[model samples]
Target chain A: MNVSRRYFMILVPAAAVAWESVLAGTPEDSPNYKMQDHWWGMLIDTPKCIGCGNCVRACEAENDVPEGFFRTWVERYHVTDENMENPEVISPEGGKHGFPAAKEDEGKYFFVPKMCNHCADSPCTQVCPVGATFVSPDGVVLIDQSYCLGCAYCVQACPYGCRYINPEKHSAEKCTLCYHRITKGLTTACCENCPTGARQLVDLKNPKDPIHAFLKTHSVQVLKPQMATGAKAFYNELDGSVR
Target chain B: MAIFKDTGHLFRFAALFVVGTTSIFVLRAIVTPKSFGQYGHYRGAALKDLADRPVKYAGHQACEVCHTDIVTTKTAGKHAGVNCEACHGPLAKHADDPSNTPAKLDTAVLCVKCHAASAAKPKGFPQVQADDHSGGLACDTCHKPHDPAIAAGGAK
Candidate 1:
């Protein structure tokens, strides 16, 4: 009787603790997912993208992103033959409603999707005074809104113009590569919603990931190789005129 | 003895300062999230918050369950990898109740999203000068949305 009572006492508390953990909701619930085992990146096939703006809309809906601020955006670049270096770029409302029909057929026009590069040596992380912004084990650059100072140093430091101080949260916000989804073994909202398979989520550490083969075969380039931020977002068929 | 007597108040103040600092440290340690430092500098709790946010997208598989015929045809076509939500928009509501039918897509604007001609696209990609391709006719008028090759010979 005494032994049974002791077991019951211990087991009851243990069961309650287990239930509490379940209620708390774990983000990384995939049994096989290990953060260190993967390095997340993206391949943006510029040629494949049609500027449908599905990605932008999906991102806003998924993240509840506020108006006038964008975590990810699309830019329509019009490069004229006469001036290749100076391309006319516009992203009216961050291309959420697609783009206006081409006014002049003479220029070379294309859409470029932009987001956080998640740089290996990210300047944004370096400049953060409180270390609130950091690169996760899976190579995602994330910001802790609770700890962020809202100084905008990281905003200024980012060469890609991805970071913004979220108006509502008053914290430095940018693309997390959808860490929550990626960790849970799902693709990012933007990648999931892209009509064409233009934006692909790549796991660099995984040998089976298609990115390895794609990188080897394709002449891919980062947005600014000169900055040498070790930007993970690779663009395929990037035009020389695109800034 | 004389020096000790004179600095006795200083010793008491030093003791109080150490005790106060220690209490603050203990409180901070207790309040901080357990996994805060596990990844890097950012609070790991934020990840859980983000993951818990309600999913807005219904995903491709959910649509495939009900629309088996469409899925079958689409899988064999050029848009095999494209999710139904890409064009239909978020179908969480539709999936929950069939009564909430998704809106009919405008075929002309939908096709032009990818087929619009541009020098930026690779020469090999299937692009058409929007104005030149079928004039004012919708893309689906000539080509099937499910399977474009069905009407491959010419405009039907």
Candidate 2:
């Protein structure tokens, strides 16, 4: 076939773009898994947690998280009986090392495991100048790292203080709730390593999930509910004093 | 001929508008990723990028398939809920390659990492002072890791 120079240039570029999509092939680890069928979230049972720091350690190893940062961390809250509102909380080294014995054998002490709340009305998504951060179809908020501007807008917008800029990559990083693992019919690193059944990755759409039943019976609360971010990380026996 | 000359400026402005709009559309079509806006506002392929990324921790169920003896012991113990990878670290590679065994971890140090007395821990949960619990002896010396309450000899 005879082609003019103008037509040839257009044809080559068009073919190049088409070829890239063909190579992409929509490859997924679990090809049969459907995102629409699931709405992902997490459950934290505070009473069950032993504060062993297993979840924190497992997340770092699983995600290749840099040192002095955390994807998930345990915070110890020591609330006095008299002044419940004035609780002393500490998360040294992102709770990687278990805390020392309590100096004050006071009113009540417990560990609160914290991670990205994966809000439905996420401020992080709203503030992204490039819209690199967005909500996934399965109700999980995710970041397209390649498109991220590393402006740290998401880091600042997050009320839970979950998001942080990866020092080396300089991109906003937070808990994905282990999207890579969950899509492949696996639980998160944090939930999997939790020895006491303190954490469980919940599929809100799945009727069989125990979360639905647990929610019915328990008083569930998200951190900073006043912000009204629709945070999906549910906490059972959440102390009113927790900040 | 008189009408054409009078409306020449208007025609020129219309032509520029057409050309400018067409070029903008072409530029967007060229630069935009094929998968953009396929799922949401972001690139659709990002979802696949995450879903396809390799995992390090082979769930405890994977280990149970091969090491039934060890897993059986663990399942019947205080640490039954603890996944194998929690203590073993990421062993997805080892699960595939039998030759690539995980390094022998020091039980003394490993046990203390979790069991050491922590103020933050729940009261019902077990805690110990490493020095007081053992006179510099490995935890596994007396307490079987799989079943901590049981002695190494299968005696409680």
Which candidate ranks first by TM-score, i.e. highest?
2
Please state the interface RMSD for every predicted structure, separated by commas.
2.9, 1.6
- Candidate 2 runs further than 4 Å off: A1-29, B1-6, B151-156
The A-chain TM-scores of all the candidates are 0.86, 0.87
- Candidate 1 chain A lowest-lDDT run of ten: A23-32
**Separate clash counts for every candidate:** 0, 0
TM-score against native, each model? 0.81, 0.89
The top-ranked prediction according to DockQ is 2
lDDT of 1 by residue, B48-119 (tens): 565555566767777888899998778777777778887777777788888988789888888776667655
Tell me the tens digit of each residue's lDDT in model 2 across B56-105: 88888788889999987887778888788877888989988879999987
lDDT of 1 by residue, A1-243 (tens): 456887999999999999998976754655667777989899999988778788999888877788988999999888877759788898989988877766546778888999998999999999988778888778888888778989999999999999999887888889988776777677888998997788999999999999999999998999889999999999999988876
Q: What is the TM-score of chain B in candidate 1?
A: 0.80
Q: What DockQ does predicted model 2 obtain?
A: 0.54
lDDT of 2 at A122: 92
